[model samples]
Target: MNPTPPPTIVIVPGLRDHVADHWQTRLAQRLTAAGRAVHTVPPLTGERLALDAQVANLAATLTPLSGPVLLVAHSAGVITTVHWAARHSADVRGAILATPPDFETPLPDGYPTPAELAHHGWTPVPREPLAFPSIVAASADDPLGAPERVAAMARAWGSHLVDLGAVGHLNPASGHGDWPLAEELIATLESGPALAPIGATPTGEPG
Candidate 1:
């Protein structure tokens, strides 16, 4: 008998969409070079802030794929995954959610305001535990999401929390390129159980 194949990698970008210097883009390029199946969700050209549209796009991306899928999401993309989980069911094996911004709270000057997020159907994030295994890699000093708040979100989603320390938003503007930690985390998630949500809440601090 043949061994089981690896899951397809699905890179889900944030509100800003794909960036040439983004770590997700780099990971996708590297994975494809290594003969791994990889796909990145295309950014919406219109209705950029509509959460429903984003969810539909993600679903459409996954609809044609066969076998298991591992979602690698960042920033608003993490929120998009949770929203997708709430309404849709697919062959999602796992997810790596990095530096998810807090939509309920008012973001910084340049980001979308809480009112805008609410009006666009991004606020009131889904708090139900996810059906699939997931890792929420949060930054201690991320300007987008406070540590405590993200920790709470991880717990609500029944996800394992990984403290990424002070990596800002883990984006190109945050000085992160080709994030090697993501590779390690992805490996762990790949070999992990189907649903590994920790029963107890963690301290939410880096040990």
Candidate 2:
């Protein structure tokens, strides 16, 4: 009998352009070394329409994969994944959302301002629970989000919350280059429950 193949791992970075030392990039390298199929979504740091296009692009990328998919998204990428999953979650098995920022609040300097964020359709982020199993990892000291807000979002999304404990943003500035623990988190999704579209009722419920 043949061994079961690993699911395709999709690495998703925030709206900013890619950086060499970003932990997500480094994680992709490690996954590649382990012989797992990995694909990183290209940078899409433009306005709201660009974000929508990027989500569509993600769908195109996953369409051809032969196995289940596990999405790993960081920062603004978490919002992207959420928006994407709202439309195309049937292909996803599970996801790990790390250090998601509170889009309804102010963001860090150099990122889009509140007006720009709204202009780009970032305001009123989706609060609906995801269609598949997911985990939302948050840092106690993340500047882009408050612990309370993250927890609230997690509850709204029906995702398990993971306290990372004062790891500021979990980015390169936070000294998270080459995060070994991320692999452990990803491993948890390997045996996660099967995918079920959001709002899909179980048997005996009216449609």
Candidate 3:
């Protein structure tokens, strides 16, 4: 029998760690059931939590995983992953960024503006090609960012973009308790090209 593939799925949850029943949490469970090792980083909280600490934590998480590593990041977690990857390219094989909030855009009322985000040390994404392939998935109605902004980020990072229709923020609050589509997307990322658009039907085959 063929040996099982290396377990290298690193799941980075958003502002807070995914709660029970959240799609990201469910996806991590599913991957684990399939014999893949999954790591969920602790949530970054408090204004005092340094962004560099978060980046370092991510790097530490990636260190022991065998390659080619596949990174799965959601929301603000996407920013963390990208920032870490830009500096630690050798640690990652590819990435799937979901519903990334654009720091370049103006914030909504009661939200921090881009400058404020930067003031808090959330840096703008680097403008160089990533060491590995990456796919960015966004929704039509994400309150934190526009589709165009997400697409532009993908282009800048040399990644692929997928537009999920009207799926507000693609988070648990949006009623996406268990996103089977995201599982399919992960399977696709494991097999084929690094970047595939959203809504592209997978050809019949395991990744």
Best by lDDT: 1
The lDDT of model 2 is 0.79
Relative to the true structure, candidate 1 has a C-alpha RMSD (angstroms) of 2.8
Q: CA lDDT, every prediction? A: 0.88, 0.79, 0.74
lDDT of 1 by residue, 1-207 (tens): 998899999999998766888899999998999989999999999988999999998999999999999999999999999999999998888999988999999888988889999999998999999998898988988999998999899999989988777888888887887788787878888887554455442333221
- Candidate 2's residue-wise lDDT over 42-77, tens digit each? 765454346577787677777777778899999988
lDDT of 1: 0.88
Which residue pairs collide in model 1, if any? none
Clashes in model 2: which pairs?
A: none
The candidate with the higher lDDT, 2 or 3, is 2
The list of candidate 3 runs beyond 4 A from truth reads 1-4, 45-49, 194-207
Rank order by TM-score, top first? 1, 2, 3
Worst 10 residues of 3 by lDDT: 198-207
